[model samples]
Target chain A: NAGVTQTPKFRILKIGQSMTLQCTQDMNHNYMYWYRQDPGMGLKLIYYSVGAGITDKGEVPNGYNVSRSTTEDFPLRLELAAPSQTSVYFCASSYGHGELFFGEGSRLTVL
Target chain B: AQKVTQAQTEISVVEKEDVTLDCVYETRDTTYYLFWYKQPPSGELVFLIRRNSFDEQNEISGRYSWNFQKSTSSFNFTITASQVVDSAVYFCAPLTGNQFYFGTGTSLTVIP
Candidate 1:
């Protein structure tokens, strides 16, 4: 079964380019989060949504935007790509603040 | 600030050897959830265990075991008779209130 699915497993973008990383969960979880992991580092929260139409910022949310239009979708947007933004992005969802199931991760590189 | 600390950046062990990954955390909330995830070369984060704050009991499943000691603010994971397949990155996370904190993850390599 597909738990949390992320699109474009790999992507390369130039500085100032823009793109959106897609995330969808079939478990119907209410809490969805966006996290980025740099080389040899742990995951850092970028944005999160408790449910549709509700979003909140996390520790590092400077260059990222997220929208939760539906229960299954929580997409993260990078309006202006930068070299510092190159990292592996992960989409995760949980039920009732429980264990989280993460996507396979989207590896993005900014030149 | 609530933070999860994994002091070990990397560890290498031969096959059939036992290994333990350390995780320390700080949280002000009365209730929280601690978890361990295994990320293999496939780059997928696989959930290994989840322990509640009130439950300080240790849990074991097959070759994996978790030690949750709330008194010490530590939730460590141990692997018995590790195999080559166990080589990967291990992450410890603690969820307090609306935020979940992750450590710098320990990379374990099992050489066969």
Candidate 2:
């Protein structure tokens, strides 16, 4: 089913630069989430979408934006990237509120 | 608000030895879900097991077992005859509705 897929597995951006982390799932899940994990720390949700055109902020949503235009795509945008935004980002999807299926993760470094 | 705590930062054990990772969570909702996920060095989170708050019955899956205790607000995972392949960071998470909260995680190293 390809499950969940994320593009740009690794990226490095300069301060003030902008980019989008792309995520897509073929499972047709109703829920999609974006999370960031610092070194040796737990994951903190950045944003989530219940369905197309419906989005909400999570624990940490600063410096980032998200949009769910369709059931298969949920993209996270980083505007004016900062050093604080350097972390491993993960995209996950699930049916309802059950167990989540996560992607391999995208490692970002902002200098 | 829901919070999860993993008191052990790191644990080390020899191969073939048993190890247990402890997790404690706090939530006001009577019906919730608890989960255990494993993240290997590759940085992919894999779902291991899940238990609902109402179901306190412990479950054993091959060499892996989980104990969920409602009274103590604890959900513990045990690995019997552990192997070097089991070395990874384990995270405990509690979910309420569509939101999920994760613990700090416990890193386990099984020395071969």
lDDT of 2 by residue, A1-111 (tens): 899999999999999999999999999999999999999999999999999999999999999999999999999999999999999999999888689999989999999
Q: Would you give me the overall lDDT of model 2?
A: 0.95
Provide fnat values for all models in the order shown. Answer: 0.89, 0.74
- Residue-by-residue lDDT tens digits, candidate 1, B9-88: 99999999999999999998889999899899878899988899998878899999989888899999999999999999
For every model shown, what is its TM-score relative to the native structure? 0.97, 0.98
> Which regions of candidate 2 are displaced past 4 Å?
none
Model 2 CAPRI quality: high
lDDT of 1 by residue, A5-106 (tens): 999899999999999999999998999999999988999999999999999999999999999999999999998999999999999999887889899899
Best-matching candidate per DockQ: 1
Choose the strongest candidate by TM-score: 2
Task: State the fnat of candidate 1 relative to the true structure.
Answer: 0.89
RMSD of every prediction: 1.0, 0.8
